[model samples]
Target: MKFFSKRELIILTLLFVLSFVPVVGGAIRILEIAGGPSVAPDNPRISNDPFPALLHLLGAIPFCILGAFQFMPSLRRYAPKWHRLNGRIVAFSGIVAAISGLWMTNYYALSIEIQGDLLYVVRMVLGTAMVLFIVRGVAAIRGRKISQHHASMTRAYAIGQGAATQTLMGLIWIALLREEPTGLMRDIMMTSAWVINLTLAEWIIRKTNNLSVSGSVS
Candidate 1:
């Protein structure tokens, strides 16, 4: 632990917390599917379809949780081979998650009245963009463009994390506003979720590279 610089320690802590969100969500979904109570399937707009939700949960576990550890500098430093191995796992599973999200946006907009079309459109655009970013990351790694690979993958992962952020934001909206969001208010908040997450991801990506360039552990 003493060997880790402050920045590295902070990043490690962040990764651990970030990994918790989706993995726990995934576990809960799996339990829900196994006949544990879940409010998810009761959504009228989603057509009560459990298929996409199932796929999304399964994909999310590996993409969000396992993917987070790929950012650990210690792992990369001491286990380069393991890093490369799990990098492949992260990339592939992320694609599955991205595609399932897009499928839900395009064909599973069952919560149209509650979620609104704008949120659907937001998911469509962001979901497709996430897939492209994942593909770009893979290509960058294949070409041995390490920096671009990292940046692209960082963007992909952050975009995926929007699901977690949106849940938190939704809770805040309900608590502070003292009511559930609807219409334009809901649309604005949902759109902001992805936009904010991606923007922050870009900043962190650049910061990590800058630190790496300056001979600091990123």
Candidate 2:
């Protein structure tokens, strides 16, 4: 039996706390309690439409659940079917979320004087790309091109996962850094995470492909 080292244990503990913290739980509760976007406040840019709020609430639930399993291989073994079911759920939910987000982004009528307008455009672009990549990946899978499907879906998932991570980071920063309510910061973090995740996913694909080809040749 392998035991975690001190550093590993500490890291795992932090990850778990972040995954199941009251703060995260509270945020989720608020969204769940709100029921949908229509019930949310209409101030600032995001409230103009209910789709973004609904997308946000829908995506957040499964994202947090999956984040927990990310660190727990044992949990995966016990529930292989559950994991597959959740994956499909996340994929479908993500599409809805992305579409609504994109629509909201365009309809948000923030002025140029504020950074929120630029951030909305950035989010729209990234969200569109994320949705397109996932759709293409699913199509590839249906055509039986397993490797292409894997790479594309992996990239899509990475982008989605990264955005969630950025949201968590923003929550932390807001709680700790005494940052004022700059609406743009949330969008910036979310958009940047998508870019960062895609870059990392591409690099991973390249490296893995090279290694596979080398092994096959040998």
What TM-score fits each model? 0.85, 0.63
How many Å off is the CA of 158 in candidate 1?
Answer: 0.9
Q: Across residues 100-207, which tens digit of lDDT does each residue of candidate 2 receive?
A: 656655766655433376576677777787788768876886797756865776676665566455656667778998773356666666667667767877886787
| Clashing residue pair totals per candidate (backbone < 3 A) | 4, 0
lDDT of 1 at 138: 91
Per-model CA lDDT versus the true structure = 0.80, 0.60
Measured by lDDT, the strongest candidate is: 1
